[model samples]
Target: MWYYTLNGQQAGPVSQAELAQMLNGSLPSDTLVWKEGMADWLPAQDVDAFRNIEATPPSQTNGSNPYAAPNSIVDENIKLSGTDEIPATPIPLDIGFCISKSWKTTIACFGAIFLTWFVYILITSIVGGVLSTIGTAIDGPVAVAPITEGMTQQAPFLPSHNQSINQQTGTGAIIAGILNNIFTMFLGLGLTLIGLNLLRGKDTNLGQLFGQSGTKLFRLIGASILYGLMVGLGLVFFIVPGIYLGMRFMFYQTVIVDKDLGVIDSLKYSSSLTRDNKWRLFFLFIINCFIVLAGALALIVGLIWALPVAWLTLLVAYLYLHDGERSLAA
Candidate 1:
């Protein structure tokens, strides 16, 4: 049996094979490992049992270690020394595995997610209703005569009833649209915080999601706006550039929400985190799009299931990338 010091505390009594599995790829190569036969603890790679096992450099992107058993790999919940942070470790993500994890997480957190959306909708509805009532009170009633059959047959070319409704609702619709975007921004931030905490294996609830996001609202907004502008500008110049930059900056929001970073710092951090993994991300994005589309095809009700699944998958990707980046830094 062998024991290892992970983060700081001693953990294990793991068998030689278990230790070898970890040393081969799971635990960092330089992790301190000790066994009964050793005089002192030494790095895993330096131990005789693991001397032949070459450590995979953190920067490697070949996806060679995809088949490692989860039980043998370092626990996803493992924290860094002196901190509660989950260290990033990039691993090959199977499409099915990603989908499955997303589905499970979405199911577990659905209640909180439902509450978050419900409140958002309620607030937006109240705001819109108030604006609508005020608009009606100021504008007075609008009356339109019903078109008779003979009149309709003679003037079939005229604008239809739907157009009338659209015309009457124009200002209110614009106001509602603005309100929806603003409210969605806040809702996104709150949900993001909730998801991040869950990913880090911390306990979080619906209330805490919104509560913690209050102080960070402006920062979130700034990061979102900056990311949008960059993507929009890239799109304006060229289609390819737009797609590339969009993928590159996709993690900006995740970084900002997770680390409370400023717009520029988050952008730079996400850019580096995603380096050499853009294609993987692209593949994941396409798969998610298809998954969502399939859900939408099912009478549009499946989006309830699909939306959360997509969100969870995205968080997994972010964590993996962030872990890899941290490992490289280490």
Candidate 2:
């Protein structure tokens, strides 16, 4: 089967013979075509299989081909402008395509992504452990009292050493959690940017994971707070609304990192990009959850592969919806 672009929209999964017939003296030489296993779309003339299919003469009228398959516009909302301008409307989300491409991407660049993730995990673990140790030192040790017959028979009211230890540990845990969350937000922005670069067939490295700073970082943090609050409030008020808003604004982080938009603008852009695709996004989320669960069941080692695939899948979907598949290619 094969697919081709017609009038800036994808069309057909037609047979080879049909494709040849459609191209012979009908479509232009420069029409883009793609099929499974191809890294990216290519001009009809550039693909050997279609080179034999003579293109319509330039002198002839460039009218629509009667034999051409009907346009299979992926998303009616998207209007391709044939340039680098980002689409203001949402594009189609093919769950299968996203997953397959993401898996391939993960395999292709596993070393870089895995190394980056491993470093992040190591840093967070070290920080958490240090804080916990400090808390333990501050609390000291608890002594256990031997059980006596009289003590067992009577109800004794006294402050427990366990309570004091817990209080001190809790305070340290609170501080650790705040610091961890702040670091995660910044690192997460870098990770999203890395994922985007990987999807676009660009080179990436460990340095990419720490490239975030300045106004973009601040904007991402701001957007994260607003996004969390809205979804948190919605979830608090109504379960359904919470789920809806979660899906709608899920792309805010990517928007801020990718487009450099302000906090509110990023949230609004994400909401717009997700319109008409909430159900699809929900289904994708469910699929990723299962993937992560499966990874966890595999003694947690599988997460090294599963997590990157899941994140790349999301980045692929973002690029597809934001600028069409063309943006996915270098």
Per-prediction TM-score to the true structure, in the order listed: 0.60, 0.67
- Model 1 clash number: 3
Predictions in order: lDDT: 0.64, 0.73
The deviation in Å at residue 79 for candidate 1 is 21
Model 2: weakest 10-residue lDDT segment is 76-85
Off by over 4 Å in 1: 1-96, 118-176, 213-215, 324-330
Q: Write the per-residue lDDT of candidate 2 for residues 1-330, one digit (tens) a residue.
A: 467777766776554555666788577777777765567777788899888777864333246543344344433222222212334334678889889889988888888888878887887678767766776565565444455455543433223555555665575556766666777777788888888888887887878778887688788778888888988998998687888999989998898788777787777767767888888988999999998899889999989888988888888888777555665863
Q: Quick one: RMSD of model 2?
A: 9.7
